[model samples]
Target: MVFSNKQLLQKALEENGTALTIVELSQKTQLQVAKIRQTLTTWEKDIVRIGPQTYDLKWRVYCGKTFRHTPQAIEIEKGILSTETDVYYYLIASFDYRAKITLYDEDDVAYPLTDRKQSKNLKLSYLSGLSKWFKKYNFEVNDDILFTCKDIKTHEFKIRRQKKQERDEFIIAAKNRRLADLVYDIINHTLPKQEGDMFLIRKYVYVYPFNDPVPPDGLIKVLANNKRFLISNIDKMYSWTGHRIKDFLTVGLRKYYLQNDKKDWIPVIIDTDEFGKYGYCSQCSERVIWESDIGWHHTKTDFESAESYIPNEFFTSDNSKTRMN
Candidate 1:
């Protein structure tokens, strides 16, 4: 029977129990090789490619309840649904309700405190006196597991520090894979790869917040210190060595900007070089885009409905608006 891509993927994952290879999937689904490759890349959230052509489904069920609340502290219980192993559970006791708490188990693995619409009472284990853990992250703590607010930037910096290595490796891998794929595409057409081609690729992958190719000085320093990208030895250019592409791709997907109240960084599509640094108001569909030198300007135009609030071509000197397949 013919199956949709999602259906086929779900079946293969269910049969394999969270582990499968590209070759095995192709054999089972009888889909074209290109389609399988596309599936693997597209199913990033559902499956993690642990090895070459091998994937692991990161499936987990979460349950959370607000157990108790008082002026001083709030308590919560979290449960996980896993058939293969024991269902995980934890009790979180927080002093400050405003400051979000991320619960970490004995193994130092963090479990996000998420909302569950329906929950049943479950006896869960508690890891006590973990205030020092939060303190290490610069979070103010009154007692065990008690949390208070700090500078948002400071908190983000600490969190970034904790995941720096993993993020860097992912960025590097993505950059390399993308470059390799582009080169293959070019070679298949028998076209010479120019130096400008590499910059174009970098620009595509790392969408700068500005009209110019140059990224903010602060952003470059962060990428360089984090070892995600390397400074050009010859020209005044920022080259993506793959260290922090995640930060770039996900720039406005979440909180928009790292600093300056979402005005510090502008977002855009790396491929089209089209500015994505604008947003529509939740109250209405009005658009906003960042003006060079000036801050964000709210326009009457809605970017989604129109050809872009701003044009792709930045200037007469810049021919980096070229698109790649």
Candidate 2:
């Protein structure tokens, strides 16, 4: 039922199409002509004067990924080339009609964008002169060329090479999409072996030695919320670095056992939660294991912990306390 003066003006202009005369905007917005005129000056850059008492809020946006030049034509996606396919639809509908198309740089200077699939289809034109422009700008293959277009009668386009810090910003975006996976890989393989499953990803790079530039925010987000990791405490997160730990209670502790000092099979305790299972092994003289069966290989002299092999005293706390070694 109500709107701020700025909101009303913006709503009216948006509903009325690209450009609207002051009277039409005022009537739609329910604002007086003098008030609209006075408010227009404050939005100088956003509101443009294309004709008498007419204002337009320009639509300028980057068209596609900024790409380096190659011999092959730029592959622009259909939806991207222009938001409104009015021009394309018209061209297709009227086969005999001819239309003038042009591309403009920031300067008012216009170039013929009218070219066919084969050659210099762009107006004021880039074929032979494109190289000269690149030379003048000193752009590189890694540099990004931002492509944007303004709201105007014809095709109003701009192509400019990002410089210095601006180029860094573009590169950072690419790192977000691509380098994040590399960071994830590094985290996956070296984990559970590193400082026991608890460390900040950003600090991990600095704490440990690595060549990769510290992972960007994107990489951090992926590694932090991954499902493979069990988040012990969201308030105080730590990695599950003890998967392959030497201790008896560690989960998945058998990627491999830490080599035991004892060379022969001896007595050991297998802790299957409450069901106490005792066994023998060359791996360790006497140890408590969480896994009931570790699947060790042995002969009868090698085969340890058979059902009949247990001495009744072996269950006694007194005998269990004694170490054979």
Candidate 3:
């Protein structure tokens, strides 16, 4: 299998006591001098380029371990030719210790800046000036900077995923609104100011201020539930019936009832022939008993203390059969 030429070169250098020239490395690895020079420039962290064609493993040291001013190193130190990510990568690779790193976007206000007067001759823009400022600050770069990049990438992905999920949930909620809530929304917002009969059909469900007649699916159910109106021949649009006089009274009462209670605005009185005499309490499921025979003639306050209603938090830890306390 083909192997990494860079790895092979570093292994050869490690084996030798201190250093090797380009010709020596070419002979040892059986590679061409041209290939050796390209590899040396790319893998400068692995082998310190000592001369035009000579090299030494970066770990190797003589008496005092002095720095080598190689032609490539000199070019890099002068900032004549080097990219920012490349500079960061080289520093982290060269240093053995961990270091904290912070990354800033080009437009971020937190990034360091140099005086425009000082940088005008160099023609350094805000972004380019950051690199020069970093060097002047004597900041030690290390491997942790790569970890910071990974952390930023992961956080950005989570933010995007979360936003998408929230948008999906909002779309679902709008599409699947409860029938009761939809009716409430219409009465509160869309029923129009100047009124004759406001007829609603499936097409005009929320497309309010419309006079057209087309039965939308679930609209008949809303009409039937409102006790003020008597419904007959529900399936047949032409034969459908309503008591206009009763609707006028109930619709007005409903406006007042809704102000106090947000629940469905059903009046306490209605035709005995249509809706039977027995009305079940929502909380208890027992027949709601009216204190006076008159029924809805009294306000909502009269029914608040009725015995038929169930108490709040009905569940008890004691037994299976539900009982009111």
Candidate 4:
């Protein structure tokens, strides 16, 4: 009763809810040890390897689970204004309140100059710059500048503020003796918190105050939610949870898992001193292009709209959507 690689892996997943080590897989599948490893590499597309030896089938499975859905509200607005000799476009989207400014060359090619962290600051800067740029070029500026703002009337701010408050509560819990002791007790006694010597749950893994705070949930949830948790092309279904489980079982945990297994992972740092500076593109002398909001589309009207002002191709027939929008 020998099973194929796919069938063997499927059986292993059905028996194990969320984690499987390479040694455990080999025992269950009754396949040669070397052959099992080879099969895993070949089938990496469907399988997510969490650590050096742990693996899981990549698919969302809910036996009787229901996830509460709370959709985040998003707002968007766009406006077009006409000057005596030029047209100006403006757009604003909700979330963190950022603004993108683009300058057009003589060929109609748009080069994004800056992305302001605050929307109000962006509006003021652009307004001042537009007046100066237009006057210097002797071009008749359009007075009918389009202005739009969306989601201005919602309680989204309150919701986000509440969530932030809750997150702070959890952070406080980590420091409190009673709460920390209770969490540790649960991990040690009740939960299957250890795989080999490493902590099964990533939250239990300790870090110094200098390091970034541990994620609220265990590595399982982190891997499940983050798209960049696993190797992309090799295992499309690989997730953070799977990666965490794999690392715990095989690599002894404590190490940060990254999509590129060959490279060591670094924590994100927020430096207040270096914030709010304009970043320049090394490839182009013009300001670096920032696609913070409003994706560009290739339309005849959009192209012709700026043809008279810029000498470059403002629009192209190649319809590719960039993350800029």
Candidate 5:
């Protein structure tokens, strides 16, 4: 039976519990060596590199969860003690939510510097209080010490802080104006015509009124509704925004569509002749194409009457409507 990249990855992870080498994963999944390498790279954001040439199977479970664990690395040169201290200070200030900070003496082991100080483990509360310390000292932390945390929590905290910083930066760049105007500017600049043009922009913010979950029914409602959007916008908003669109339709908009009976879930865009003439190739064929094409192909349409499901706004221009007609 055939399996998608997602499915194959899931299977490989399930079969091999913690970490898996690239060679072992390729052999077990029967996937091309190159494809396995590519998948490993794509999955790196979600997976943890336990050792050299080994990846932990975390992506399958924590696909896109906010608190998912990721990997991070910090390097410091020898003799740069001040620089290392400053790095730790900044890290604690930035990620007190999910990271625990600790300070080690010159001996490479942690010990309380003062009698009043609690155990060596730095708590969230202490890290949160760092801003006050920085303001009082007029200088940053030293740079020679090593700091570590629970890998997953550290990753999650970094992701959250980075996202917040990015959103704030965008809002500041956009002159702290309304989201609607930002959206308008983005749409205008990115897709001037909105044909097949696609691009992704990171760092977006949104605002919604607070009182009601559905953002007041009418225009005259007032509440402190605000939401921040931050993601690399892919061309055709549906690629990333589609998930948001789906959520809106189900929960916010109360609209739903029946699922099609076909096995594939992804929407396709291609002509009938193209699909028919190039139905996916069977294995052992003399195609000489890349190994990555193992399970990628256009799905066959069952000749059902195609519906005009494209949004009405997409046809605002008379010329576009005429072409569709």
Candidate 6:
């Protein structure tokens, strides 16, 4: 197997403790110095330049927790301070503590955050955070701030707020969304960690949209037609289908075409970084305006048009049949 550029650099950094020059790294890895420099620039989070020609691996002393590339925990706290679902607390450990989170505001600040699995109720994890920080951000019930775990050992996390247009914070509510979208969000969320990644349709009829529940028949219609949520024939269960293109925090750094309401294919330049996924429309400014593998929908207060995607989170690459998400 061939070593990737990042792998090569990581090996060199670990062996030498990051005291090598570009020329030395090139010789060790049998790569060009230009390539070495480029690799360092691209993977600076792993390997950083200390002095002019010196470098070091950016690692922290921690407990014996192996790191994994985890998806950021979205909708960390749905601004409403309530215990709505049992699944809400396990939301982080749902993926084996492999989650990162942060909240966006008109401005940003950082605080120490931690979660404790209660000895009394093993199922519930009591999250202790800076309650005053929420007040400082002035987060209304409509806003969502995702708090990502930076270090499990130290329980330290950072926060930042973007310009309103390029915000990671989505100021939206369920009632205002298209009826189809409401069902999608509810079912997508309520899908249990079961055999099929599915949810029972009738289970949520009265549970979803707490203020006003979706009609059981209409909810079935949304699930039946929407390709984003797939229906199991035998069990009559629903799961998030593999048709989302602009999955905000999960799918990253792939090119896509947004089919607007006019049916024009506008090329989208999507990219990913430490913060989160970004770049949907030249005009949308980091907003994931496209819907799952069907059509596009701007998720601001008022959503318009009917659309889906040809490919979504698990889409075929331009050059090959391999899936990228």
Name the top lDDT candidate. 6
lDDT of 5: 0.28
Off by over 4 Å in 2: 1-101, 106-108, 118-132, 163-166, 170-325
Tens-digit per-residue lDDT, 1-325, candidate 5: 8887657866777777756777776778788878866775522334434344565554332222221111112111111112111232233222232344433322334322111222344211122222222223232222111122223333321111122222233433233234233333344343211111111111111112111211111110110121112111111122212232221111010001111233212222212242231211222111111112122232334332222123333223121101000
The regions of model 5 sitting more than 4 angstroms off are: 1-3, 48-52, 58-129, 132-145, 151-325
**Model 2 clash tally, residue pairs:** 13
TM-score versus the correct structure, for each prediction? 0.29, 0.24, 0.22, 0.24, 0.24, 0.27
**Tens digit per residue, CA lDDT, model 6, 1-325:** 8889989977986888536777778878898877877777622444645445655554432112111111112223422221122222222322224343332323445543454554553333344454666556654433333333345333333333222243322322222234344444443343131222112222232223322221112232333443333233311221224233231112111224444565433445445566444444544443445544444444453232112222345343222222222
Candidate 3 has an lDDT of 0.32
- The ten-residue window of minimal lDDT in model 5 covers 249-258
Per-residue lDDT of 188-254 in model 2, one digit per residue for the tens? 4542422222222322222221223322232223223332222222212211321223321111112
Please write out the lDDT profile of model 4 over residues 242-319, one tens digit for every residue: 332332222111111211233322111111123232222121212222121221212236434333131122222112
Question: How many residue pairs of model 1 clash at the backbone?
Answer: 4
Candidates ranked, most accurate by lDDT first: 6, 2, 3, 1, 4, 5
Worst 10 residues of 3 by lDDT: 153-162
CA RMSD of all predictions: 17.5, 22.8, 32.5, 25.9, 19.6, 18.3
Better of 5 and 6 by lDDT: 6
lDDT of each residue in 38-147, candidate 3, tens digit only = 77663244465654466765434211111101112322243222222122222223332132333334233233222232244543211123344234333232101111
Q: For model 4, what is the alpha-carbon lDDT of residue 27?
A: 85
Please report the candidate that would top TM-score against the real structure.
1
Off by over 4 Å in 4: 1-3, 16-18, 42-46, 59-162, 169-325
